[model samples]
Target chain A: MENSPKIAANPEKYTFILFVSGMSVKSGHAIENLRSICDTYLKGNFNLQIIDITTDRQSAVDYQIIAIPTLIKTGPGQPRTLLGDLSDTEKVLRILDIKS
Target chain B: MFNYFHKKNQTGVRKIKPSKPQDEKFSFPKTPTGVEGLDEITDGGFPKGRPTLICGGAGCGKTLLSMQFLIKGITDFSEHGVFMSFEEPSKDLSLNVKSLGFDLDKLKAEKKLVVDYVRVERSEIEETGEYDLEGLFIRLNHAIDSVNAKRVVLDTIESLFAGLDNQAILRAELRRLFHWLKEKGVTAIITGERGEATLTRQGLEEYVSDCVIILDHRVIEQVSTRRLRIIKYRGSTHGTNEYPFLIDEDGISVLPITSLKLNNEVSSELVSTGVPGLDTMFVGGGFYRGSNILISGTAGTAKTTIACYFANEQCKKHEKTVFFAFEESPQQLIRNMKSIGIDLEKHIDKGLLQIHASRPSLNGLELHLLTLRKLIKDFKPTTVILDPISNLITVGNENEVRSMLVRLIDMLKANNITALFTSLNKQNDNLRPDLAEESVSSLVDTWITVRDMEGIGERNRGIFIVKSRGMGHSNQVREFVIGSKGIELLDVEFGPEGILTGAARKSNQLQRTVKAMKLQSDLDRKDREIDRKRKVLEANIAALKNEFESVVEELGILKATEDLHSKIMIENTPKTKKK
Candidate 1:
């Protein structure tokens, strides 16, 4: 997966797992917003795994998720979690340690 | 903890039907809350493998009760539990129960318990579309699975409403969550905020859980009391009264007032009242060993003296005794009893007596009873004495005092401990009887009335046995004296005037003595006159005999002269005639 041209260009890899409640409007919006931010800021240097908590409940629990549509940045230093629909893009980037 | 859950498949579909009244075939198993008196009212405990709703206002011990349930489940029942708090963080929760001797950190370290804090910030969350509490479910499930918990607590579940604006979705998700907990076969406690009109603020009680318990904190007459009541239980018969509960350093303890039955074991042994004369007034020397005694009287009529005597008697027997002096301090009670020839300090020094002296106004009546219960349990006393229960009447109303005393007496009787209670009757209302005496009279087995009988220019103390069940006792009122030598019952004086006491008794004795002396003098005079008459008759008889003897002597001389004239030849015949 790392051999793709988009991921091979950058040495700094940001790994994230976004837990969502199925395909609800809020979960879908949170996933889209997080992907857009990653694509715009990281320039294909990040690895994001989207998990539907309704189906993959174990992964959600393993991350101690408490709110639906929660985004967790697990790599590149300390882990940080942002709850809700990820509507505040600036706060999300700051929490994920994304350089503007 | 993890290893135990590995043996059972996590995906097993065990459907838990919401218990219905008509479902006679299935009985919900109880989970023993392990609270002191809670299990008795809950019919062993909350419904097992079902969600029980506990709703109350703020500061009503909703969180403390849940914490105690979890801690007791882990320590007493050996059942692991998970505490998921939505209000206080895990650190605050642990620190709060530390005063109750619950080491939550140690339990978590031992893997027997798990504490998870779920923070739901209203500012951080924006609900835009349809969503579920799947994230909460996963977190709770993980916590439970980590400890293989048999009990689960969600403290303040209504806090989610504060963070989410979608009430319809929140309600639906909450219903699913309760059902899921039951399906998992774990006893769960879900606490909620009380509503103004409904049982829960968010109408959470509509979910039809297995049980619903409501806690209330109210201040009546400037005294605060916490009460617990079971709003509904699906399958079990439980106490329906609002039981008073206490939250102290030992956590929450519900006082089951009427839970005691009349089937406690009874003993036929008798215990002395410490006064020898008083013992004879009782049929079997004294009262029954486990029976309750009531000493009701007016002021300064020796009610406390009697109670102190009973306590002294118990302690002298090497039995533990606890004396609750509500009106006096320990030093004052000891000193007062010392003046009455009863040395209570010795028993206290020997460790056989425990004096708990406090003002009745210091706390509510329920707290006093709880304190007595705790002391009795710790000391294991064989005898308990409450000096002047009338003082307690100041703290509570008539009904509360009656209920408290009834529970107190019942507890003592159940433990087979002898109890003595003193009550003070008013001076003017002595003939009418006091309220305390009238209320507690029926509960006690022996009723001793001590009153002041004022007669003949002095006040005298009189004691009488009003009632003694199962034994014959003295029916006559005996006047008693209380001095530095202690109490002594004088014999019943039966004079023409009635029962005499004080100066009347002394005057009656004096009158009887004077009458006896006068009668003795009259008898002596009559005996002298009779003696003189008999002497005179004897002298008259002596004179008559002397005269008759002289006549007989003359006749004998004449006959001898004639006989001598012819006696020459008839000497032999004269001798024969003389013979």
Candidate 2:
């Protein structure tokens, strides 16, 4: 819902913002994949926010988003952006520097 | 953003209302770019509401051209624009265009322009699975709607190919992007880097088929020139020739006038050649207004002098004049002309004349022509003079110089500016067959040649009109002197050596006067001798008549003596005979 990912309230809390187009099959898979990965890896230690760019398109511009299902992990290290449906959970974790 | 495209697909409806019925039947709608000479080449401008691909190599002015289009649209046509830069950020773009006098910041503040910097960093991005460019569409739509922009510029959209992965998905997304832009109904320009094989690196020309413009920067010898060409404009007829364009402080100006047709309007009005005698040589007393006149000559044959005279004459008439002096600086030209009594400095001070002097090697021939074209446009001169166009030949080969001259002459003629060009030929070369003369002589309305007429070990300047189209020009070569009083064409003289000039002419005149004087004295001596002979004969006849009278008197006396004894000789002798 937020245009920018909020600063982690707790310094160690993993924060992620996922941007997607409205109701597309790829976007649906990306949302489910990210939730499952966060649940399995960090359990209740992470905050996840999902935004449909079709509705909050202004957020997409502010975030410099180009591809759909883009996930930005802003925590534990420098922020990193991930593209596509996030179906390759291992590749997404490797890019975000998350050991799972 | 998805709904916008989805709604259009479901209804198969165009977001833009169809153009006026008659307009649709006649011609496709066009949005004028308002760039100088570009609207003429496009035959109006880019196709309205369609994507146009502008491709060129790096530093070939592709971005500047697109920026000019957007700025000109807003400033000239009052249409707002959105600039989506895949290369430079908004701050950098503003700084770059500010040098060209385009205040992008001001335009943004006024809500007339929106610059969206789309940064796609490869290091920060990870491809997981299937994805589309819906985010780009969303950002572009938001920017366009914010300003209600009618024009959009996606400068070098090829940068996306570098940032994104998966060619199939990217290609499909690009297709959808173009379609979405069409639905938005804004005239859009998509710039691409030139490809080795295709028009664009990503072959963007394949997607944007409505119009394709290519910009080329070529360096011949050591000079570089920028040229523009319209490869295609689907529904409109456009000028397909490669036109030289200039990027100065004012932005991109394409020189689109290469008049292939000889159908320019002719003026019977005469513009003096500045030299009265030269004007008189043309039966009409001067050149036809708007006609091209070429004066080819050997070095020091007063070619520049004649050109200056023409410029001075135009300025005297209070008409503007632009003198492109290739050989001499303005100060030097003004000083040189002053020696011949032509005070060009005054005309310059009066703002009636502009002397632009540049080295021929400073720029390519195309740049020279572009510069001249710009000067003519700004000055709007009634007369234009290029002192020694031969210098331009040094920068380019014969064909290039000829083509440039063709464009230049056409531009001048179209503007109805009387054009005079001076060409310097080699010292011993025939003036007719040299580079400048051979190329431009045929295209000009008047071709005048000045040469060193060498006679009796002295050289004299002689001028003659080689050809004058549609006028009765003198077929005589008149000797001219460049005295302190300017160019004075002497009366045509035919001597024993034929068409004598200068010192030779003066010597021949003296010889003629001496011969005439000798003949006059010889006639006087012959008349005195004849009068003496007639007086002597008259005296001899008078003496013979007196002798006859005396003899008759003696005979009468003798007859009277005998006739007193014989009736005075006869009468007395006759009376004696009767007694």
Alpha-carbon local distance difference test for all models: 0.84, 0.86
Instruction: Report the C-alpha displacement of residue B217, candidate 1, in angstroms.
Output: 1.4
Instruction: List candidate 2 segments past 4 Å from native.
Output: A1-11, B1-25, B429-432, B522-579
Model 2, B99-134: lDDT tens per residue? Answer: 999999999999999999999888888898888888
For every model in order, the TM-score on chain A comes to 0.84, 0.85
In candidate 1, position B8 carries an lDDT of 23
Write the residue-wise lDDT of candidate 1 on A1-100 in tens digits.
3244434454669998888877778888888887788777776777899888777766764565666877777778777667667777877767665656
Report the alpha-carbon TM-score of model 2 versus the true structure. Answer: 0.86
Q: Against the true structure, what is every candidate's RMSD?
A: 7.6, 7.7
lDDT of 1 by residue, B1-579 (tens): 242243123312222243444457565589999888999998889988988999999999988999899999999999999999989988998898999999999999999998988777766554433456779987788789889999999988888889778787777778788879989999999998999989998876534467899999988777777899998886677899999999887988889996356998899999999975899998799999899999999998988888888888899999899999888899998998899788988999999999998988888888998998898889999999998898888888899899999999989988999999999998883377778998899999999999998875689999999999888998988898888988888987878968888888888879878988998998899999998999999999999999999999999999998888787668656777787
What's the TM for chain B in candidate 2? Answer: 0.85
Interface RMSD in angstroms for candidate 2:
0.9
Top candidate on TM-score is 2
Candidates, DockQ? 0.28, 0.68
Worst 10 residues of 2 chain B by lDDT: B11-20
